[model samples]
Target chain A: MTPARRRTRSSAALRVLFAFAALIALTSVTAVVTHVVNTSAGLIAIRGGTESAATGDAAQVLASWTLLESMVYRSVIERDAVERFPDGTRIEFRSWLNPAFITGGYSADPTRTGVRGALIGSLWLIVIATIAAVPAGVGAAIYLQEFSAPHRLHRAMRESVHLLAGVPSVVFGLIGLVIFARLLGPLTSGAIFGVRATRVPTGRTIVSAGLTVALMTLPRIVIAAEQAIGAVAPRLRLAAFSVGATRWQVVRDHVLPQAGPEICAGAIFALTRAVGDAAAVIIVGASTVVLTDPSTPFAAFTALPVIAYQWAMRPDPSYRGLASAALLVLLLVVVVLNVAAGVVRLRARRTR
Target chain B: MTQDVGVANERVDTLSTEELTVTYDDIPVVSDVTVGFARGEVTALIGPAGSGKTSVLRALNRLHDLTPIARVHGSVRLHGKDIYDADVDAFEIRRRVGMVFETPTPFPMSIYDNVAWGARMHGRPSELDAVVEHGLRRAGLWDEVKDKLRQSALRLSAGQQQRLCIARTIAIDPDVILMDEVTAPLDPISTGKVEDLILTLRPDYAIVLATHNVQQAGRLSDRVAFFLVDESRAGRLVEWADTDSVFFAPRDARTEAYISGRAGSDMSARGRTG
Candidate 1:
């Protein structure tokens, strides 16, 4: 074949192949969307316990009720219950703050009050875990990356840390249950802190749960921190050392600041993961619900996912709505975290 | 800024090696080579690939210590003082003799920071801004990069980056400057600019450049060293002479074949006698 004609034929064939590939990609996207829609419809039907489409007024009322529920009905219902739900109902409502153990009021009623208790519990766990984990994890990573060299023991330790990161959350829960709840929790509660601490009778309290979740997430944060620290160009370190900066000075002034955003980003992601982790909390026995907030660190607590699970599994059909609402709240929190991360990334880029 | 040619006439020899041999990973590289570099003059080291031009250049500033496995035998004297003497601190040695490497490995930093790094490393001139500006001016980059001092060194074109590397090295005000294929990566015009920088800087510093470009060596160097690979594949200094004499009347057949593009033409000849 003439070189020119051969090139033309090949180019034409390539164009056809690219078109075919484009068609496949479009069809695949359509198929995925269709599958998702169908699955969601099926899930909605299962949740609703109805195959037939709702009749005219029923469909309209349900749709409008959803809107009202979001915008106004929830507030009105909450106000009415506060005014007239009875002292016993109020006390049960307050037990959510205590967890079922030392319950003052909050209960698993799937009410707005109960869901609020769950939200507070989850947020407390996430925030507390983040506070405890960030320093510990990032400190360990800094020590490993900047202070230590590759020795057999250190390498083994680093590998073990990575291994810890891969352990199942449920397994961490079990460990937390055995160690913190069964051992340290009781010791700390009975001897030192006092009656308030002992309110977590089995030692499986908010503090224990938070600590457990921190342990479960610690390895992930450390590993990511290590990676971020390691990602700093060696030239920077060399430059610092050549300028007579002390080793610690290099880390404190240059390395850590440069690694701050990445480490914090990883820690935030880990904390978000900790927020949604129900399995570990479940193992740590986070079932108690007190309507009042924990006055102390050792206080028992329940998390949103556990509460959502309890409400969602209930035989009552109305409780399903509460589960959906809780799910929506969780999604919102995750979205907020992702958006904050995006903003931070943009700022970092602009600074560089 | 041409040096007083009388500088060469005054000292005759500013730096010299006695029976220098080097090895890496137990493999012999350069062996039994004796040469001298003249004062305030450009001395070019040219040789075939793996003829140990770089290893020899690195030894001059004791930079070979940076490589854990590199071994050296022989005494290299600067102003009659053996540079490798135990009392000589490597940092002090490096401060006195600076190097610019191939590929323009500028610090991942602002252009101003890159220029000031060496000075900072050597604990010189507390006024960093002034030092940076002075270094850039000397490098002939200040006019183009004056407005972009805060910009990343990497933002500059390759030629500018190479000059930035030179500025960084000279910022510390070293007595000797080593250029290892500094212009090999530049276009002819950029190469000429660098060659001009070399010429202008000669009055203030002694230069030892290792280049594969024979014509470049002829054009810029006052003295030339020709290295030859012997049967043992170890580099040997065959001849070191005045630049014109070396290029026009090279004493060694290997040097003649090399300059004429005949000896080991397919392989990179890296040795230049300095």
Candidate 2:
């Protein structure tokens, strides 16, 4: 080979070597930091005589590297270790995630504290929010992108919707508080609907909270959906039009189906935002300590984020550990949502 | 040129436009154009770029209504009915007058669905399979695509996609088929196939084709309307006559200059020479 070719080969090899070194360094630093954090948190819990401190550390380390939290928890439960602390306090190691932990209602008693009720309530909130937002958002997007005339009023409406997306979630919560909780109180609480059941005492129930989150994320869905619809080729619209399709038929048959994956992705994004939202839910009077499953839209509700936030604010070590576990669950939920979005996008691409 | 209008009325023209003017945002692109298309005949609208050839073809089927700024004046009559009347639905007008665009545009669907889509819009027809087969065979695509009818229309070659679009138009069974530079983007072989398809389709549909290819126009059209951008940059009909007369013995000097290679040259020089 020529000198230049040889030099090029050496440079390429050097680049590969550098990239390998960088990846190794990154992994080592991350492992060292995680180990330090887990060890310190564990030692502090132990000093405070928390029963599940050691197991919690093991679970955290396992969760950090892999999906082995359940295995560690199971091992700890089976061992049933009883150890005496320096202060002569006897502690028993136990699994933090049990069926009772997943399904039971909240309790102020630390031993019985679980997020099952909150989890169910949050899921219901997502369902309600999706129903409230998706249709309205997608419809508004279709109107703006496909049918709306290019006039000042329509332009202003578009700009206002875009502006609404940037507004704080708390502001929407305030709007929900006034409109849903107070103004529509009787209607939402099933008093006017003739159900004769008021689960929240006040009208600040899951219905109100769900609507609040829906309002908060409506603009995001509309913008995403509009962009998706707009991205369809002008040729496709022309083709459909040339074939004698009406405005509604063309949009329903060609435009909406093409934009489906992006619409779904946007809905998932709205759900992710709603799932982690605490301030709006709090303002809309989602109970901080709900003890029963929300059986209906009129029922009182709490979500994992609220419980996690409440737990983190407490001055107890065990409460902080519970908060960490709750955060892990929230992260898992977000990952699952993103994976679902990916599958939808893949299917959409394949359809074309 | 005016003599053709009298003859146009004498014959049972399938579709006709009277003094049709198309404007976008109040600027006229096609002005005061009177044309008629007879059944079993190809009428080619031959013009330069920006001469409003596509606009005129689009106006025939009311496709310009989709553009927010476009405004079409005068009447486009299909089967003696004024399509621009307030009570007339544009969709119904389009159902009678289908169109094929310059670019191939197959819907993002299966080949069968692409052809069946138009027929199914009213409701499911009892002989749906027969209709799809007829449309595909008429467009000369059935032999190539018969085995993979379930495949996505997008997976076809560029030429095949254009043929699929033709099949889709034919499936609707329109009285008049508007083709806006339909073969402009195709290869020579594909263009040949499409040109053959257009000739085959001429027996049943009043086909109005707009194209920049003078040779293709001469090959396919029975009568040709030559449009030119005037001093105002508004497209106006310079000459409309039989294709042989227009191609060989043109009446208008501008039509001759455009048909020849001297279209963009100094008009004043040609005027002084004449």
The TM-score values for the models, in the order shown, are 0.67, 0.84
Measured by lDDT, the strongest candidate is 2
For model 1, residues B59-79, the per-residue Cα lDDT tens digits are 887766645578788999877
lDDT of 1 by residue, A1-352 (tens): 8999999999999999999999999999998555433321111111111111232121111111232332334456445544653432312211111132222235432222345556667777877788888899999999888777556878987999999988989999999899878888665344355665535566777777888889988998999899889988765654444333456766875688778788878877877777888899999878745556765566667777886677678776545555554555665677688777667756876776
How far is A335's C-alpha from truth in model 1 (Å)? 3.5
Q: In candidate 1, how many Å is residue A103 off?
A: 20
**Candidate 1 Cα errors over 4 Å, as ranges:** A1-108, A114-158, A174-198, A201-215, A221-275, A281-287, A294-299, A310-321, A342-352, B1-39, B48-97, B121-126, B225-245, B269-274
Give lDDT: candidate 1, residue B131.
Answer: 80
* Poorly placed runs, candidate 2 (over 4 Å): A1-104, A193-199, B1-9, B264-274
iRMSD values, candidates in order: 4.7, 0.9
The candidates' DockQ values read 0.14, 0.70
